[model samples]
Target chain A: MNHRVLLLALLLLALPSWAVIETYQFDTDLQRQRYNAFIEELRCPKCQNQNLSGSDSAISQDLRRQLHAMIMAGKSDIEITQYMVDRYGDFILYRPRFNAATAVLWLLPVGLLLGGLAIWALMASRRTRRVPIQPLDDHDRAALDSLLSDEEKPSERSGGNS
Target chain B: MSRIKLFLPLIIFLVLVAIFFGVQRRVQTGDYSPTALPSALLNKPFPEFSLPTLQGESLSRAELPKQWLLVNVWATWCPTCHYEHPFLVELAERGVPILGVDYKDRREPALKWLAEKGDPYFATVFDEQGTLGLDLGVTGAPETYLVDAEGIVRFRYQGALDQKVWDEQFAPMLSSLEEASP
Candidate 1:
């Protein structure tokens, strides 16, 4: 394929979504930022892994329009999320809410990290805390004496020579 | 306590394996759908829509046939709908009241497809712009919903429908829905 042809195709592809979104007139910079955050956060129901901003799928187009309408109507972030969730369930969210169904997903890794640190602290504290040594019993002392006999003989011979 | 700690990694591994096998079993038995989403409107009333039917006649929520029925969503663009057409015709012949939604499809092609394939629905709602589908949380075509007599959405099945799916997944629920009705 020619470079010119490839570039033309890409240009044409970018036209659709750009046309719709540019037509939207946001009142404030904060509202514009919210729109950007929203399209990124909301997952396209029809497409896998493509958020609303990335995909030009039919569902995404309709949802983008609805989201714009909601934001323009002064609906809060929570209300917008609730509206999407009510229709599409938690599947539409890139970041699912912390709830009974998703509690494990949200909490498990953090819980593991904390639990591991706690165990490490416990083990480390235990290791550094030295216990007092008991005096050697008579049997142990005799065993130690028998083990040192070879070196003791040299000392004995040296003392005799002295 | 420390003795059990030694087997903690082993326990975690075994638990993970068990969960994997459990999910695998569910997948095989069709209890879990890894791709198709469970409908958000489960046990809720069907979304309100006043749309023209396939024949261009007006219809509305209050005018819905007050009984246990299947609301089948399909489109000419979806190849799976073509595959499931015969099964739908068969079910309709067996006295199943099926309402169709022509999802995001041109009326001419949809009508042509139905005429050629043999129409299976009692009333086919024409949703050309897919507004009704958007309200219903449709991801794509060839989805089905079971609405009880009270207009509550009892079940939703994504993808094509067939006898095996009907017998295993839908039949028991349909029976229960009927039993519960006065």
Candidate 2:
């Protein structure tokens, strides 16, 4: 047990030494969690489809440090996000704000779904409204019966001759 | 009415296609730099930071020139800054005061590069940690900001500065600022 504990401690110590660990001091666990979420929500401007937390680029690193400083300085979430947006535009945010430029992006899917439902409803209502064939009247029934009898009599006479 | 309705989506699609093609042509012709993110510091007061100059003297917003000046964010490691060096040298020789922000670069290499390439700046601030750069919203090197007499950022230009870019973008604003000053 003593040997196993020593080996485990050695492994843990060696693990951290080789890694480039980024440490940020937060006043509270809540603050640290907020910082993590904020960084994940921010897109790295220099990278392709990468959040600031995942990006190791120089700019992303600098931005992360700046964000840490701002959070430590007691800035609110709105203030921090606004500061980023003011510097990098709305492109920095993972969730883009609703604006004139992004209106179509937000509304197009809803519009398409409503349109499809409208078309489906129209087709269904038209199908229900279609007039089914009226039941045969008495006169038509009698005529159909006489026609059938006349055809049967000929067949019967042919059978007798055969 | 139903016929028109039936063609509405097709008409909308065609219009969208035309708009897309128009934008594509504009992009292909290099009318806009899509990768160049817009600077949000325009018309805002320059961020405050006191940094040491190459000669070990402190530099800050208070010491900035009262007249129009250019603050160029550059580094020795950035190749585009080297490409823009000659143009900056020319501008400096023509009496334009350019304050260089040596962004996240080593002091020795920065000094050596200036000595070799000819220093175009009135003074270069050494920003080794990039703290000042973060405050300035600088994501990359080779960005130039034109500060008005009052130290407000009037304009920002990203990428390498060439004669045409200077003539078209920077010059007009510089002249206007000069005219409005006195």
Candidate 3:
């Protein structure tokens, strides 16, 4: 009778605390793929250096599922990204969107490239002017011929001896 | 005219050098974006491995109840591990149980580091051979995995953590989970 009471207590203790896992399934292939891409491109803010897709950080996972649900509910890519940006700021996007605040982020590279080309053209032209010269004058040609003939001198002596 | 002809190649060489340096400078000044892998592994199950703790006690994914967990793979040899240690401790105090895998470290030193630094994990697993680390796609020390309650591998971080990241990326997502589970 005591053993039966102990067994009943153990079963009651185990019953209420069981975790309820919520599983969400995607209905369409296109929505799933888009959700996958969006999460992969967005950086995981907590881990900071990894994207939501690549990171196994808990936050990244939650964000991925959230993005997945949003996509399934028919949110556009722009809307999804904007919603994240509105909440988290523009730093979430791996390729940060263009705006007045991020114009530098977008345009700085192009400006630098153009500036580099300009500097290159200037330096290239300057170098074209400063390079030292070497001339193939008549004297140099004569010297070269004498040097070549000088090598034959030893052979000529050997030929004479033969 | 012949002198000019001789200098043409020399001029071309200098021009090439200038172009190279110019390109390098441009590269240095631009934004450094994070290059991350695709989402093929999202909601996938965590890799399986059971190993002894630094204390010689056994530890594995099965030991913990199903919840969101941060599995940090680190070693004493890793310099970046030190950089992220404090953040891990804070995460632990906040009720996020961290499972520390002391990869490639001697038992004595691993225990000492934890003792001095304040133990951040509910348990610490030893992966001295790095076999378990490789199975989870750990490229180096200081990698983290976020596993969901169902034991699904939810996310992965390849490097150190910081405040800006914790605030912008990690905190907001966690809010939703707290709402969902509570």
Candidate 4:
């Protein structure tokens, strides 16, 4: 009996997750899918963090109703999104449209990656490069001769040690 | 080049500091609020609506006068509405045309509220179902919209209206709007 009560309590806890229960009849499965997708993507204006599907705020519920009615009336996705944008501004959209303001947001990561790649290529190319061999210069040769003369040849030194 | 590279981090940190301080200043001054959305209907015509007045009379676009006015969204349930009531009353006394939208409010409580606190609105829109409020893109009660003489939505403010807000934000805009009109 305790186990059953606990199970029932757990089931009741799950009930709140399915907030705002309103039956929306769609002509086809695709239409229903579109409705789900739209609710997920559309932000609740009142509850800024929650989407239409997650929020039970008055505005969110109303928007869900409107979305369902629009779908039932066979409005295209663009038309429906545009309708939302017209009323709630771009803030309603979870993914903001590409515009002058949002261009920086979308392009910054890609730009940074390309910049990093260019620097990496430059560093890699630098690391792989070998200084072109120069024939011994007169000054270098003179210095080299002085240093060598100061020490016995390795062959002679090794032979003496043996 | 290496010396300049050394300062790159400092430069980036300075830029970040500048950006943060700029945002902080705006937030401190009450100029920036995350929840307040810029109205999509700015510079657009006021949305058309046919609804009943508090007096049981029909009101529509035809009834809106060809004069600049304020549309205030309020409800008896909203605490801020009570806070701003006196200021609205003052504005109305100063000959500012004010229209009230009783958003998602019961008729009895709303009527009682008006009776207890003097009604400042020239005409009160009975939006019990929140149809007009939804059309106006009202996120919550105590939102106000400034409509120009041409029926254009000039501005939408999301908060309780006060004297400071009036002088600092709305008054300058109102004067400019008045000057622009023939």
The residue pairs that clash in candidate 2, if any, are none
Q: Relative to the true structure, how large is the alpha-carbon lDDT of every model?
A: 0.90, 0.88, 0.74, 0.90
lDDT of 2 at A144: 78
Model 1 lDDT, full chain set: 0.90
Q: By DockQ, is 1 or 3 better? A: 1
Calculate model 2's interface RMSD in Å: 1.7
Error of 3 at B144 (Å): 1.3
Ranking by TM-score: 4, 1, 2, 3
Q: What is the TM-score of each candidate against the true structure?
A: 0.78, 0.73, 0.44, 0.82
Give the true-contact fraction for every prediction, in order: 0.77, 0.64, 0.00, 0.86
lDDT of 4 by residue, B1-182 (tens): 99999999999999999999999998888878777888989999999999998988989977899999999999999999999999999999999999999999998999999999999999999998888887888889899999999999999999999998899889998999989995
Of the candidates numbered 1 and 4, which has the greater DockQ value? Answer: 4
Fraction of native Cα-Cα interface contacts (under 8 Å, chains A and B) also present in model 1:
0.77
C-alpha displacement of A136 in model 4, angstroms? 6.8
Q: What CA RMSD would you report for each candidate?
A: 6.1, 8.2, 21.0, 5.1
RMSD of 2: 8.2
Off by over 4 Å in 4: A1-20, A115-162, B1-4
- What does candidate 4's lDDT look like per residue over A1-162, in tens digits? 999999999999999776647878888999999999999999999986889988878778889988998999989999999988888888888998988867887899999999999999999888778565679888888887667756967665554422
Model 1, residue pairs in steric clash = none
- Tens-place lDDT per residue, model 3, A72-115, is 88989888887666434566788987888789989999999999
**Chain B TM, every candidate:** 0.91, 0.89, 0.76, 0.94
Q: Could you tell which candidate, 2 or 3, scores higher by lDDT?
A: 2
